[model samples]
Target: MIPKYRQQFNQDFSQEKYSLLKEYLKQKSGLEPAFRVSESPIFLKKEFESKLIDASESIIDQIKTLSPDLLRKAVPDNCYVPGHTDKPHFLTIDFGICRSENGEIEPQLIELQAFPSLYAFQKVFEDTFCEVYPFLSEIRNKMPHEEFKNYMKDLILGNEDPENVILLEIYPEKQKTAIDFVLTEKLLGIKTVCLTKLKKEGKKLFYENEGKLTEIKRIYNRVIFDELDRILDLKTEFDFREDVDVKWVTHPNWFFKISKFLLPLLQHQFVPKSYFLHEFPENENLENFVLKPLFSFAGSGVNLNPTKEITDVIKDKENYILQRKVNYEPVFEDINGDFSKGEIRLLYIWRENDEPPILLENLARMTKADMVNVDFNKKDAIWIGSSNAFFAE
Candidate 1:
């Protein structure tokens, strides 16, 4: 974060500007976001920007070289989908800003997701950000606007009828990412269908639209894999694990293969030392490590401060990961004069068989609590929610 811009931006920031921006968000999204959008965006210099990219590349290279045996070990038994794609269509790598022993601000790898972030909505978010504050209108990000849109089109609507491609979810309206689903529909002309609503005959899947069943050719799956079982007596016409007649934009198998499961596999200066909870040595200091459920999303089932009792109670060792906690430095100055800790999530996209995904955009989360998450900070104002950054050369 730059001191000059931070001071200038804070001085210039007004309640009316944020008020109009919030209203625009409500208007653009036919629905209110279940989560809060931060008031300001992060401003980054080129030096730190390069560090973030170096960290992402190191992890992605490890993903590319991961052996089949090691990758297979990541699969949750009986949870593997029949059709596994060679590469994930979308992935996100999260990094925490930390101060090195040398007293320099550096990026430390936190977590990664093989799923999409707010891809469609981010453009709208940044656009609205600039629109509200007219002087900041020339802000630019990593990927060009038109190029990114075309890339998404190629990934989501590839060689198939856009009508047949649906964004798959379980009770999509309940998820916080429901806005993304709506934006996906508006941009690609694909509908968001509930998993329970899908009808299957033999191995083919179809969904009723306008009183007729339209065959589904592809699915931009947003359904969290774990949620599939939690639904009580939920009879889906087709099982996700079944050899169904649809192409997965990013197959389910890659989600497990490239998730927190890969954290232990990644060996980098930026990547923290990690171990499977079951295999973690008794001699090693567990006091500094954080216990995380491998598959939980949006910071669920994570224990920031864990005890011996917590680790002993876990029956499924493979499902839990013991990760070293990177102390997120409170570097971003808040408008109220209280500094806040932040986490920067770098979003990447890779086509099938691509060695490494291209860094598409950046997502930042700010918080005043132990963890940079919504649940961690319930009532913190400004610099406390989802945001983006402008990388200046």
Candidate 2:
């Protein structure tokens, strides 16, 4: 972290500025953020930024060479999607800022996902933060607004007409991450379609767009198989496992292959020792690790302290993991001098021809709780929520 910028931003931060920031965001996106937005943006020194990138690269190299059999087996028999891609189009690797045994500030890998994150909203949020805190503009946007928009257009829309490309989700309007969908549509000229609304005509899929049946050519998938499985009463004419005549911007199978299911398999200095619940060593102390449900989202089934009672109730032991806890260094101090632990997520986009994913942007969450989720945060916390990072030039 860049201490100078952090100190300057903290000194200049005011309640009014924070209010203005929230207002600006609402005005831009036409809706208030469902999740809390932190009062500060992280400032990363060049050296720290490099370390983060290097850590990501090391993990990515291993991911690329992962056994094809392992990847194919990661997808559950019932949840397998048809037309799987050879590689993932998007990747989000999260790392907790922690102090190493040698007293160096380093990033410890927390979790990762091959699914999309708040890519559209994150850049705008960074810009909004800079707009409210004018002095912070010195860091500048890593990729200019127009350039980033063009990149997104190519990635999500491809060569298809924007009307033919849809950001497919389940009840997108009711989703917490609807803001990103809204912005994605605004930027790429695509529409968000609910999974249940998709109509099947042989191998092709169609969705109602502006009262007309529009054939879907490409899909920017945002639906999670786990969440979809929970909707027992839901019915959709189209199925993910069907061989649909549409391009998957990110093939859904990658979600499982490159998720927490692969975390235990990753061997890196930044990655914590993770083991499947069924394979956890009997002699190892369970208190030193956190239990995680492989397929859950937004920290739904994360237990900070794992016990035999909790593990016993779980019928699917293979779907759970015991990950060694990484102590998040309280390096980010809030206004009241209380520090917040930060988890930085590096967002990457892998073009079809690119060997490795391109690191486009970074987002961080500040929290004083045991984890970064809103449920764990105290009611009266500040400078602790959804945030972005600015790296030194």
Candidate 3:
């Protein structure tokens, strides 16, 4: 969002540099990034970075207190977590940032899930950053991708056989982000299998591979329980809660444990004031905030400028939230040399043996409107979706 850095980078930009960046990325990573890679990254002020880290730490501490209970409730069956298991213990937390009324960059907690993101592609993206942008050698703005991969391996496999641990997802072929699934397979050497492929005998889960039934020792679960509920006649003998043989990469409870629904409960100076849509008191200035469905994904079912009648008619009040709208600072300068507003999704992963959460990757979204959600963008906008590039500051 620092305008001076943007101007400096644009002033020194050249077609030769851009061509080199593209060639180097394709040669090194074998995949071309869909977004722009700029000469200059976001220059996050030290104070702002520190505040962001502090806020994240505070939230983590809070979560530590309640995580055990939350985890217990998330299981469909009441079962205690086992101590020794060769499965991935994964945790992810998401944050949404905005400029506060005081004109300082502030972060608001969005959601946390015990699921795998585009972990494999992220590692490749980091490698591209190193190859294309040699000037960033001295900068500390990069995520430790190799370290992250090792940590994941250690957490998921432990001392057990890597062949036995599988990253479990639904029929991944039917999923939109199957490219990520393929990447995970290539990086970890773990098979990505559909739930239907799994055959259960008693409490043990097994999948037939190469015409033989192999025991499923550890499960790196990527299936969303909400999505699973929609399957009509899909038969699977395994029970996620009752089966002791399969270990969770991320225990399912954390999805609900740290969600946007809890934003109204967390007291933070940086977080905008929020309330359950049902519990929201009558305010004549209803236009001041946005109404959002608690559990929807990718900016679905959100009313940016909600009216009183719209808020009043919501039947599932508990399933909705009203959050004060914060203006998105126009941070990214586009190809046309015009400024575009955007939001950054800071990706983090917490391993079983790690003392603290590790920042693994970052994905930014650009938009032309006052808000950064996809619905607000114009039809012809080019720089409005998921973007990743070298950021050194």
Candidates sorted on TM-score, descending: 2, 1, 3
lDDT of 1 by residue, 40-108 (tens): 877777788899888888787778788888888888778889878778899999998888878888889
Instruction: Give the alpha carbon lDDT tens digit for every residue of 21-44 in model 2.
Output: 999988888989988989888776
Please give the lDDT score for candidate 3.
Answer: 0.63
Candidate 1: pairs in clash: none
lDDT of each: 0.83, 0.89, 0.63
Give the range where candidate 2 is weakest over 10 consecutive residues by summed lDDT. 134-143
Best by lDDT: 2
- Runs of candidate 1 with Cα error greater than 4 angstroms are 378-380
Q: Indicate the residue-level lDDT of 147 in model 1.
A: 86
lDDT head-to-head 1 vs 3, winner: 1
Residue ranges of candidate 2 with Cα displaced over 4 Å = none
Report the alpha-carbon TM-score of model 1 versus the true structure.
Answer: 0.96
- Model 2: how far residue 84 lies from native, Å: 0.7
Tell me the lDDT of model 1 at 365.
85
Query: How displaced is residue 113 in candidate 1, in Å?
Result: 1.5
